[model samples]
Target: MTDAAAPPGEPEAAVTDGPVTERATCLLAPNPSMMTLEGTNTWVLAEPGAREVVVVDPGPLHEEHLARVAATATAGGRTVALTLLTHGHPDHAEGAERFAELTGSVVRARDAALCRGAEPLVAGELLLVDGLRLSVVPAAGHTADSVALLLPADRALLSGDTVLGRGTTVVDHPDGDLGDYLDTLRRLRATVIDDAVRVVLPGHGPVLRDPAGAIDFYLVHRAKRLAQVESAVEAGHRTPAEVVAHVYADVDRALWPVAERSVRAQLEYLTEHGLI
Candidate 1:
């Protein structure tokens, strides 16, 4: 096992946010760190012929950034009419209400508490914004209420933290369930295969042109990590921290806390599966 799971030789996403499909433009946030590789990505979606656009993930509560997102959408005489959140993570949804106020749009999210002046997003819900259809898919890995958007028109997927553009996403323990995370990845993989989704617009990092490859990488990485954890446990690493020290020895110490959270989720999953 390696300290970092290699990204299948896929191109690393650019540090700056960039355009994805024809209709989606990513507005990168100012915040960047180990967890938030580049920063939160605020995606603005619009049809070429429409005046109304839809903004996804308003990012953090930075006033200037919020204003920038509004301005970007309103460029070329287009206006933002709807705001959607992939999840309730602060980096992704913290500025939603402010962005809604800026664009005079309603904010919608899977978590009811995250919704403002709009109904919670439902799984399988069909949304028609600017003459484009966005099919909501329940993701719920990084968080219990996480979701990813499927744009059939462009064959693009707006995946939140569930499927990032860079490294493997953490199954955030307590709130993040490893079992459900695996299910979500499997489901997304099936969508990539059956629907032929070509592009992945992640919540962070650069846009992925190879959706299938990214999904396959995530699924494989998760499986390999689970096997390593099982092996570590069978080798007498009974605690999550002990397992982390053994299985993630090569990983940076600063990330051990985050790794422990995922390790806990993995332990729970193994226990449930009777693998330890």
Candidate 2:
């Protein structure tokens, strides 16, 4: 299932369009629809005046998409020098191997082994490919392995599923923790308040210009939702589904299933804290 033949949708290429040879290119994943928000976004960061590029999130194991990524990097007079994964989710890493094979680039990530045939990306790692300097920042919570990339020159942050352009992300249980997620959000807020980040290139949805406001809203929203869930549980909602019914009474019923996952995570958190 390469990008080209990726079931009619799925980002067929790692990088589509951006400032061209200026620096970075953004390719939207075809895996769009209501559930995924918009779709996963694969970005290509190239060094100005250089012929080498860094690929981010190969996007699903689709062959056509992989070929497109290879071709796009070539079109920019750049070769894929490295592959970086923000996380190990299938949508972001599944196509990494095939794409790497196509471009002969090494994979760089926090857990390189999660990325087929690549090395792990450690914190404070500085990747200078073709002259572009990328700083790796560990952004856990969305997932324990999630990482964020900072392009200091552009004051930009490449936030994977740890944050979204629209709406708040689920603090899924087992791998995701509400407390940890809040801490991560606070860290991001620090970046925003410090003016270290002016723009956010999220994994899904459009790029966000108001990173501070967005993060603040997410924190407030999550806190409110957690309170609501707590109140619902206190009101006799025993299961996740029941909590969803009470906490999300006005939300679309279709979203209940997804809400249930979050509710369950909250329940577990509460139980661990002896609040249940």
Candidate 3:
């Protein structure tokens, strides 16, 4: 699935899943849907000439998908040194335990509950997976436990659902805070510009080549959505359902339910900031 054949509505891609950088490879999961787009991108990161690799976001509990990911890790006869999760969403970390069993690797995540035989990931912690280096940076907006991994050598960031390869990610309410999300995005944008990031390996969808540009797009998109939500509120859309009807009217109705959740989040943000 090259950029030319990226399917309708999917982001441009030279390839779907393969070697993304010198050390990164994405294995597209079998799951596909409006929410997942193509599928979850299970990333394998290994150092040059290393004998072991790190697997990220093993995706669902589907046995075949887990096996495929393990196969990809061992393609070069290297072992899986560890499994890292971006978040605890079922779509991303549900297979963590199973994948760990398949590879005999420990699972590590920002959430203590998700870790197995390993301590919870710490912000700014540098992880050495068989020789591959990864920095765990706490972004925590899409979900309170959401985190991103940075591979400095590859100039790539593994942005869970905080930033997607295409489109914008929802700031899920309750667990997800819009204010925190904005802060996270600002930090990520600065990281992209300062770190000179060239690639972004998202948990789901095709890879992103222009990290700065993508983050900028997301920032602008969020500002616009916030403005739109403010206007909807000012226009007398008093409830979440009412606001969704106005702000997300252009979106597919099937997604209106999810849109309402985001709308609720926006309303909370606005209210907290004294804008509504």
Candidate 4:
């Protein structure tokens, strides 16, 4: 949520130009909003000789979005075998059920309430849909329900909001904790370092390379922000709003609301640790 320029690493990905008709294609929604985010990236993944398609993040419940996704999958001459959610945020899940209804596909997610035929997706769970394998990785932090899907064949991760192509993600307290978030980053870093992950297809924003570097930068940024918040609190900025003004002075005011949530999380962490 900081206004700081995105740390350099991977090149930006272009929006999907046309219908995704091949094995690996992505369609970016045209609309981008604070809620929708750089438009949810609906990934259509297929494997060699596969007869079905896998849809990652059905995005908002927008009729047009679902229609586009269906059209793209149908163009590939395959039925939508499954719908996967990285997390249960409405932006990412609101349309999952509806999309499943439209495509007659079952939804697989860590949160069953968010998808079809309730199944908890724990880490290291592999799902095979028409020979296209996606490994569920529990990356809780952005939300308690957050998870990332790892496609070993493609060496790609559908990171959802746990990682992003633009700015860093917010850690809303109560459901979002900085400690858990940092742990998730560390785990993701190990995956990146092992060269197991080649690219990140996030819930919002474009795709990115250098998954390890991006996760590292995000961790470092969070540390720096925590320090700044600690310093601000020591320098007489105690309330969340006051800390936001001081610690995030350079960040765009439009995003301060989101920043405030992270700031509150940091404050709780500090208070729990007797740092304030």
Candidate 5:
């Protein structure tokens, strides 16, 4: 789910399929597209010298990718004790069940239907797995079920699709609410400051070193887009398609369809708040 391009000066590290931090390693999935920047990031997280590990967002249902993630998580006598999904997007959670089966781990997600062998994730839930502390932070609006994991020990955030490494994410209207998304961003900005978060281990693209700055950019970008959408609507761009053509003209045509979802979300927000 792509949207507006990332703002300038947002730091992006060169992402590869390897260890990103002392407690986290990334396994880039095989699936890559305009929607998924590089690919869905299958993150393997564990404490140093710990025998148990946690895997997050097991990418697509591709057999090879799942196998790789399972292998990476279980390497050197480590056991994959838990599987967590950021959301139910196929690109992020489709392979979770198979991954759990492979590692004998239980899968947990905000959505009950997506959970396997475990209860759904709750906001503010602290998961203590093998000395690793991960706090479940509700991050709805990328999808209603999206949840971000905060690895406090490392001062890192496992930001599903709520925040991306290289570009803005789609609100994906109806299921995604712009109002909720805006609120989420504001909350995340505060979290970044209060927690002193150092890095964002995103689901796509690369790791973000400036969590606060990136979030601020997202907020500013959203405000700008909302203004553009409002202007487009007032300019007699009656339909979403017309609005997309007008407001997202700088974006790729192929991505207009995806951008339309966010435009609709923006329109809904505008209407609800009497800003349109």
Candidate 6:
């Protein structure tokens, strides 16, 4: 899910499809909307001088986009060795099968159903492709199967929808849990501190330079929103819709449907912890 709010203190830039780092390039997809800011960011990652590269989040079933991702990954005579998904969201994984067909690469994801010709990703597993080392980090909040990839060499974290480049991501309730998301955020904060992550290559919007600061903002934002939800509940907001209308009245009505999902997750969290 996506957030309508822009990231606080982040400098906005023209988000285009191009290289964001020495080892990473972002191909901005064509699909843009209130949810998908700019578009889904399809990342191409490889170690410098490596003959094989990995593609992350193939994006929607847009044929041209998939073809472009394949072309970009296979440029300079390098082969697209693997396709990885941050989650099973259609915006991120819909093009996986098509892209795999175009690039002849194995598709791997946390969800077994999403994997094609490859095993599901195991948390903490090191994916050594050519010379690039990507550490699979289980990030289950946006979705049960969401994951983040850490590129130690580049000090970069490929944060799918868990930590967006701009604004925040939706905790798609039922499938997503707020408690789990909060835990994921805390874990990611520790990972950033311990691993010295400097940049975040998000699934959408622009690249984030200050990984710690971004995550801190997300944590603070979540806490504030949770408090608001709890207050709304105490103030007689009985349903998710009522909570959304009360807590997220300022947010675009177009986003309320998704916001309700977050409220549901938060309500569940509060109920489980006996906070409400």
Model 3 vs. true fold: TM: 0.94
The 10-residue segment of model 4 with minimum total lDDT is: 13-22
How many Å off is the CA of 113 in candidate 6? Answer: 0.2
Better of 3 and 4 by TM-score: 3
Q: Relative to the unseen true structure, what is the C-alpha lDDT of residue 96 in candidate 1, on a scale of 0 to 100?
A: 88
lDDT tens per residue, model 4, 25-77: 77776668764456777787888667798888888888988898898886657
- Candidates' lDDT values, in order? 0.85, 0.74, 0.84, 0.79, 0.90, 0.90
Model 3, span 1-276: residue lDDT tens: 111122123354533678889999888888876677778888989999999999999999999999999998987788998899999989899999999999999999999999999999999899987778999888987889999999999999999888777666777778888898889989987888888888888877777777777777777777888999999888998999998889887777877877777778889999989999
Candidate 5 off by > 4 Å: 1-3, 8-10
What digit string (tens of lDDT, one per residue) describes model 6 on residues 1-276? 444465654634866478888899999999988778889999999999999999999999999898888888998899999999999999999999999999999999999999999999999999999999999998999899999999999899999999887888999989999988999999898999999998889998888888888888889899999999999999999999999999987788989999999999999999999999
Cα lDDT tens digits, model 2, 1-276, are 000111111222333345522466777667775555556788888766778888889888877777877888778566888889998888888888888788888887787577556568887688898689888877877777888888877788888877776666766566767777778889877866674777777787667777777777777777778788788888888888888888877766877786777777778777878877
Query: Candidate 4, clashing residue pairs?
Result: none
The candidate with the higher TM-score, 2 or 6, is 6
lDDT of 5 by residue, 151-182 (tens): 99999999999898888999978799998998
Q: What is the TM-score of each candidate against the true structure?
A: 0.95, 0.87, 0.94, 0.93, 0.97, 0.97
> Distance (Å) between predicted and true CA of 71, model 4?
1.5
